[model samples]
Target: MRESLGDFAIGRLDAEEAATVQAHLDGCADCRAELAEVSSVLGPLSTVDAARLGDAPVPSPDLGDRIVAAARAEGRAAERGRSTPRRLTLAAAAAVALLVGGAGGYAAGAYDGIPREPVAVQAMEPGVEVSAVAIPHTWGVEIVLDGDGFASGATYRMVVESKDGREVGAGEFIGTGESKMVCNMNSSVLRGDAEGFKVVDTSGATVLRGDLTAT
Candidate 1:
């Protein structure tokens, strides 16, 4: 029959849909004839009885050798396939756009010959800036932001805090240009078992934070 009913032909519809299709099939002799033809072609096979299917075909006595040869041939083919490899960009093109934007920070005279530390701008929209904090016993914290366009040079700082209050300990470690930085806490920071953590920058400002859950 000119049909490929898939799971539908088995009368396996759950409820409402089953009733509808069953009704249609019952009234449709053409569909029934197609099913019959399929059944005839199948003969005793029916639903592909595994019991009567018999053992799988045995290979020739030299099967092991043949298999090894085939594997070698395949490996050679794979080696050849691997040969035509393409080079990747030093940084993803998008990174260039982000670096210009703020994903990596910039200095007042970053574009000039003046040397300065680069700031990591969040790679996400609306770029993040440091604000204030009130946590406790946190040591060092590093971070990577999500967004594009970071400044080339400039140190992003954290909001300052005292030894008491909510500010027990806190800080961050920043690299020149990175999507992620580390956070060293004064205490074991359990960021709700998150994928990442957050932190403040050098000047005691909220510089980095994001994605905390799982990889």
Candidate 2:
């Protein structure tokens, strides 16, 4: 069952196997904890573009050895009845290695070759400060928002607009006020077609606007 936790977290297991794991997790606190850890590590990987992975810088041999060492330690811990799952341990180790090897930077639009358009964010209200970048992907565009000073517990929607006035909902998230929020919203509209992005409150009031066309 522990070997299947990694697959379960990534949705790779068949329905029957997943159901069994779900049942086990429901009754086992230790397994639930392990699953949570695995999910935290793997969650960000879901948004990664697999095709661009080959372009990521390779890790040094020492880094590879360290990853292997960490995986072995996790396996030993599992043998001692610890909560760490063997498969999940390996998956987490691989994720760490990839991130450390520079894939993480690529995912964040840090690659020089990748075209990242800076969005000029204007806060409509007095208390909010926001900044963003638009990164184009094969599937669509990824809008990375970094900001502080939003109303706590308030929900905001990101809208992507085209030059012709067509609007598309990128995504939505709850605000945490001054905690320095970082969000990645994706839209099916291509970056070239997108004219700007707007952060709107539930009442349909635009609180923040970023003009991509000007950039």
lDDT of 1 by residue, 100-175 (tens): 5574343222332322222323323234433211222123322223332223344543322322323323343344
The best candidate in terms of TM-score: 2
Clashes of 2: 0
What tens-digit string does per-residue lDDT give for candidate 2 at 1-215?
A: 77788999989999999999999998665578789999998968888989998896878869988999999999997788745576688899898767745554423444545566677889998789877889877577889887787799999999999888889999999988889877889998877688998999999999999888963
Q: What is the TM-score of each candidate against the true structure?
A: 0.27, 0.52
Task: Output the lDDT of residue 124, model 1.
Answer: 31
**Pairs in clash, predicted candidate 2:** none
How far out, in Å, is residue 132 in model 2? Answer: 0.5
How does each model score on lDDT?
0.42, 0.83
Q: Report the error of model 1 at residue 18, Å.
A: 7.7
Question: What's the true lDDT of residue 68 in model 2?
Answer: 90
Error of 1 at 185 (Å): 21
Which regions of candidate 2 fall more than 4 Å away from where they truly are?
A: 1-109
TM-score of 1: 0.27
